[model samples]
Target: MAKILVVDDAKFMRMTLKNILTNGEHDVIGEASNGKEAVELYKELAPDLVTMDITMPEMNGMDALNEIVASSDDARVIMCSAMGQQKMVVEAIEQGAKDFIVKPFDEARVLEAVARVLR
Candidate 1:
């Protein structure tokens, strides 16, 4: 199990993610509503993994993903967005996201992505 940061604008999504990760025995170090908060908390918590949502009120996840990667090459980020565009996924990978997961999160997929990134 890894320390994880869950970033999403939706409260329910964050809570749901928390439940799943906790069940998987991973400690959720922190949660962020947007990419900006994600970055700031990222610096503070420095979790083993970050699950980020794409669209938000301020500072989208991709930009935050880039920022985090720029700040720390060791940062392991998993993009969790509703966006299924091939270009977006490719760009996220190019920008240093370790993995991608679609929203309306599946417990299996989420855990699988986390495990893959942590590996």
Candidate 2:
């Protein structure tokens, strides 16, 4: 199972992702409420993957993805956002996000992204 870090400002969203990852047989090594925490946790945990929400307090997922990718060229991150954030999704891919998942999340899609990124 891949070690994953889940980053989202909303506690409920974090929990939902944690459940999904666990059910998919992945290990959730950490959860962060914002990009700042996500960056720090990523440095410490060195998880195999990260699921990052696009909008958050302190810093956004785009910035966090940049930071992580800057530090580790091979870092695998999947950007997550609600519907209608297509522009940001495209930007995220350009910034090095392995994939993007639109919320409310689908079980199959989330797992698919996770599996694909792990591979």
Q: Name the candidate that leads on lDDT.
A: 2
Tens digits of per-residue lDDT, candidate 1, 1-119, equal: 69999999999999999999999999999999999999999999999999988887799999999999999979999988685565787899998999998878899998998998898
- Quote each prediction's TM-score: 0.95, 0.99
- Best model per TM-score: 2
lDDT of each: 0.91, 0.96
lDDT (tens digit, per residue) of candidate 2 on 17-85: 999999999999999999999999999999999999999999999999999999997899999999999
Backbone clash pairs in model 1 (N, Cα, C under 3 Å; residues 3+ apart or in different chains), count: 0
Clashes of each: 0, 0
Q: How close is candidate 1 to the true structure, as a TM-score?
A: 0.95
Candidate 2 clash figure, as a count: 0
